[model samples]
Target: MNITPSLKKVIGLCLPLLFSISAIAQPVRPKANWQNLDLQADGMFGISTEKAYNELLKDKKPVPVIVAVLDGGVDINHEDLKNVIWVNTKEIAGNGIDDDHNGYADDVNGWNFLGSKKGNVEFDNLEITRILKKDWYKYAYADTTKLSKDELAKYHQQQKLSRELNDKLEDARKNLDLYTKVKTVYERVFKKIGKQEPTLEDFADFIPDNPMEAQVKMVTMRELPKAKNFKEFYAQSIIDPIKFCNEEINYHLNLDYDSRDIVGDDYNNSNEHYYGNPTVNGPTTTHGTHVAGIIGASRDNGIGVKGVANNVQIMSVNCVPNGDERDKDIANAIRYAVDNGAKVINMSFGRPYCTDKAVVDEAIKYAMSKDVLLVHAAGNDNEDLDKKANYPTPFYNDGGHADAWLTVGASGFRDDQTLKADFSNYGKQTVDVFAPGIKINSTVPGSAYVEYGGTSMASPVVAGLAALIRSYYPKLTAVQVKEIIIASVVKVNHNVDIERKGKIKHIAFADLCRTGGIVNAYQALKLAESRAN
Candidate 1:
């Protein structure tokens, strides 16, 4: 039930904003593992992983690199992921004491900052809701004439966000009712027609006896063709959206709801870090499991999807939640990963707002000092990040940015005008590069595979590539790896359509990102080898 930052803006307006049901029904690529294919040989804008592995890395032995997945949670027991899951060799499993004496006890895999002995924090409020909850009493009835400029601006911003949140809640409730009624209509019609799973032909053959049945029949006929069967369409279109709406009403936008009590941490203290339990796979593991599979799912398992990197250990650091992640948890997660020997940390979650950016900034610096590369999702909002800021950015408050950080945008499976994912956020200065994110087939919970689209999926592609390079070229610094990846991108020399504000604008694909190209695993590896030599 996790939502990307970009999807948060339009989630209530329509169905789940990440991937449309129609888009899911008809994928851009026929195969799930098209992201690893070559653009020239396969006609898809992939990272050329197969080419790289066959041509260059055929006989080369790779040193296992630790890549930390900082997300909601991960299914460590997943068959495709279990082999590659990082095990803390120094720590004893199921022991209450911190055997390694690193403040975390029984952290055999990684740490969960959103949990304690009580339970894991499943759902939390958004950053905006938290902000309003803390400051509404201070500014709600204040005299505008006496307020300072910054204070007045903050007040107005809060007011606008409050209105937007309320509107989205109302929209969610309406959408929930509409979808519930539609589901009921479909169920009644299906029962009356005596079909357990109806097809388009089945719907066409049956005659509706009532107005509700007639309406259901029309919708089923129109949508059933887009899906494999009636049950799938119902689950994806109706059940999933209903769950999202319920999550929004109960947690994300609910001011009274607080999951921090479960954590039992000093919420006011930004530096208090050693309080979370060792439950890395929290309540939900779908989002984190998918991200882990993209980075380093077991490649030689002969089942499920092959990950981008072969010789990598994925350390699951559960910090993100169904809603916005807290800055403290994020900062602690970064530090934990760095301290635990993670060479590359993949952060596939983000938000548009930050309550304490300085703490996270300090943690970023800490990771940089420890020679850790951080790959982040630019966002899914389809907006220019230069104008609108995203949290956990490389840029610091004092001025300079982190050299080891790479912000990635989502690229589609084509090589033409639609190369850039329509929902991917881009910036000539902010976004470092693009990666194969659209219709990405990756591992989910219970040994299954699914397709997801977003910059969230894109970031792990680059992270896996980074891990690949670091594994082969162990001497390359994090900053050097960042430079090599950016310098060796597959340059797009054509125009692409990007929606700005409300209108679509045709712009040079190069203008969207710093490199004006997509991340190329083969090219990046070639560059790393040359530099290593």
Candidate 2:
């Protein structure tokens, strides 16, 4: 059972195909079911949780609940989110010192594992970066007495890739900055020309060719306030991927190995604890803030959308950085949440694969040991996960998961089973359930609210439902709670067809996910009552 650091590297490279699953789109579904189901009236929260909540209210079990959100940082100051922030009793509020011994001090709200420094975010490991650093040599070359040609080929591939990534990262940074600048300029000009929202039809006679390439067009189009013109301006500002590729090749890829660069800890000693204080929280919370609001922003405050869990405390864990989350930080975050008392967890992030399998596995195992129900997003890549292995999977690195883990995918406005979102990851065997994901409005940083997309939005929907179940049916174990969620969804439009393998393929709702249907909170409570009877 002793795995060296080198062995972990080999498995990561060879297992590129490990979690490669297809995300097929579903066919047309009936809209009547959606209309007949009063998403508002059905739930206690007066909002659709995909399942009605009012029915769950019959049992009359409501308590202050807690859900951990693992994502980019959350905006603690958001108008909708400022009220329900999880307070750490062990640590003092807003103090510079770590009085509590919870490892992360001053985490009064949450942690921001990914700090706001743009350059600080590391790039994902691509084939190219492995070459320039020759870091791949240690993993691919176990013995130097006899080297394989394949090894040499890999080195060459890495070299070529390193150059490309360096170029990519730099270009990406510049383009991001440039686009914002150009957008500002364009907005300024568009407003001066057209005080009100204008239409693209207004410019039918005037066309800007190679619009995206034309900086002039970007400036003019952005100022127009019309829906069509706004779309046109958006299209014009799109930067070419070429710029980002070259920069990534130069900076992060060509850089040397420095594991100590991020958190300033000795990564060599995984058992060495007491390196951090408990007073950590997020700084740039655009993504996490929105997700928190979806799970438990104060409802009916006459501001934003209703959260699924009414009386739940949201312990914002700042584990995910702007890039992929470090296994060590995530592991620690899991333990922190569990040690502090979190029953339901929501993870809205995933990497292409797990770099540190042991670290991730142990953390997930630890969470289960506490009987926590962990829910995760199926990813936004639109690939099938049945075969493809994404990082932080419900199952351990070995592909066998302990119960209490649920993998959720995105469902759209369409009611048919065939209509899996064009952006959602699907697997008849791997994914556990589905929820609404399109155009979700949630809280953001600076007390603002904006609509966002991706299965990232879909995850909180289920986590909230899981909380509601636990709130009403406290007798149910984590495993039973997962089962009730999967077994009770209404299979109204079971048979549907959607895109798969570049062609339309027919499938049943049960075939799309392990659960076979979207979550129905209303049915869940009814089932819980029956079990009690």
Candidate 3:
């Protein structure tokens, strides 16, 4: 699949009725830069990016900060991102030699761990599927009597995950069928109406000539008011959801599907680090491009959306695939970013399981030794992470947490019940703070801009604020920066609506995260300046 739909899109498939109703009653679109707006000055729950730049950073000379975006892939050549894209100054481009002698040859930009000389791995199996596939033959037909205690536990887990995967795959197949039928109906309606892109007025005035026409008309009339045109509705409602289902069936849940050969690395070798190609922008760059733009997309550029941090270089370290990223790859990516002088690393991907967490834990410790801060996204599962585990966590096997790590949840633009993003994963002990992630406008592939919602979007917001702080205060340590950001959060002291166990519940906003508030760039800068003085 050339297009890799995100996990949020899959969740949307499960709640189509709720989303459809919301679409029918959708409000006017917020400003493109609403995520950067100040809460006090603009009445939007943003990071106060503009106010900080205009006031605190107007006269101060900023030191350039390198922030590594460890995601799927980034379009380094994006018009708004080109100037801010990090360049390996010592290495020459297209020389077919390891110019910097860092094991990666001709790495002028950054490296793509997901690609080899053949091509990039656009999609791969999820962690659960990989776990099931690894021990399938041994336990698929083994007798329970022959298994030892540890082996029996492993076998039971395998069986449970197997059943879950089968059930999910079946649901995906059914959703695919349903979306395909709806798409066909939409096409028939459009063909009958003789319009490639119908307006709301066109849909409102549309009269049914047949049973199928009437059915589609009813659907479109309920849905078309929010969409600007039929093409937008068709793509969002039909095309993207169908693609998400296909991704689930063909790659994530398919044990027979393997793309590791494309990388040509020894699957058993955890020590192998210098194997991937230099193609940083893989087949799909939508997710990574949007993430990079969120952190540092050339603030002075007249076109496209403004990024969070200024005077920062975004290093593209492509490691994540469409599905769950591997532990070995994540560990290597963190080490690579830290070795290459990345002061802060943004990891916007996570899964529920960790096959080998020791490697990742060691990598995070390595980052801490180098005084590098790591910011991660609380996953979009909308669960409490204090009870459930998320991979690449700050808490190591030994007991101590990584002081340089920050876990972020998604916050929205409103101060009402919707302040916390409905899809954000939360935990008072696990998540550090919330940031603007709902309907955030950022750069995508081909110089385009769009709004996307996820904890993936929220992680970069905190990472950007960290970069902004580092840019102004060069003397602050990574731990100090992390502390300042958390200590200076804009506190929220009211109840907010959150969905738990498939039920809407009103909970204190303070209970959602450790900071009990949203990230504020302006406040963080003030605290950093005070500490510097």
Better of 2 and 3 by TM-score: 3
Q: Which 10 residues in a row give candidate 2 its minimum summed lDDT?
A: 10-19
Best by TM-score: 3
The whole-model lDDT of each prediction reads 0.84, 0.59, 0.84
Model 1 alpha-carbon drift over 4 Å, by segment: 1-28, 143-154, 192-196, 199-233, 500-503
Over the stretch 125-156, how does candidate 3's per-residue lDDT look in tens digits?
A: 98999999999999999899999999999999
TM-scores of the models, in the given order?
A: 0.91, 0.74, 0.94
Q: Compare candidates 1 and 2 on lDDT and give the better one.
A: 1
lDDT of each residue in 1-533, candidate 2, tens digit only: 11111111111111011111222232222232231134444321112443445444644757777788876556666677767777777777667666676665566765544332222333333323433444654544446345488866655565665566556555556545654565465455456446333354443334444444254443333333321234432432222222232333443334553323545566555554444433234433567777788788776588766777667788887666433456666777777778778898888877553446687688789888888999988886657788785567777767778689888877655555434655577898889888766545667777765555467777888887788778766777777888787877655356655555555567676677877667766777677678755
Q: Write the per-residue lDDT of candidate 1 for residues 257-299, one digit (tens) a residue.
A: 9889999999989999999889988886788999999999888
lDDT measured at residue 222 in model 1 versus the true structure, 0 to 100:
62
lDDT of 2 at 205: 32
* Number of clashes found in candidate 1: 0
Could you report the Cα RMSD, in angstroms, for every candidate shown? 3.5, 8.6, 3.2
Clashing pairs counted in every model: 0, 66, 0
Among all windows of ten consecutive residues in candidate 3, which has the lowest summed lDDT? 11-20
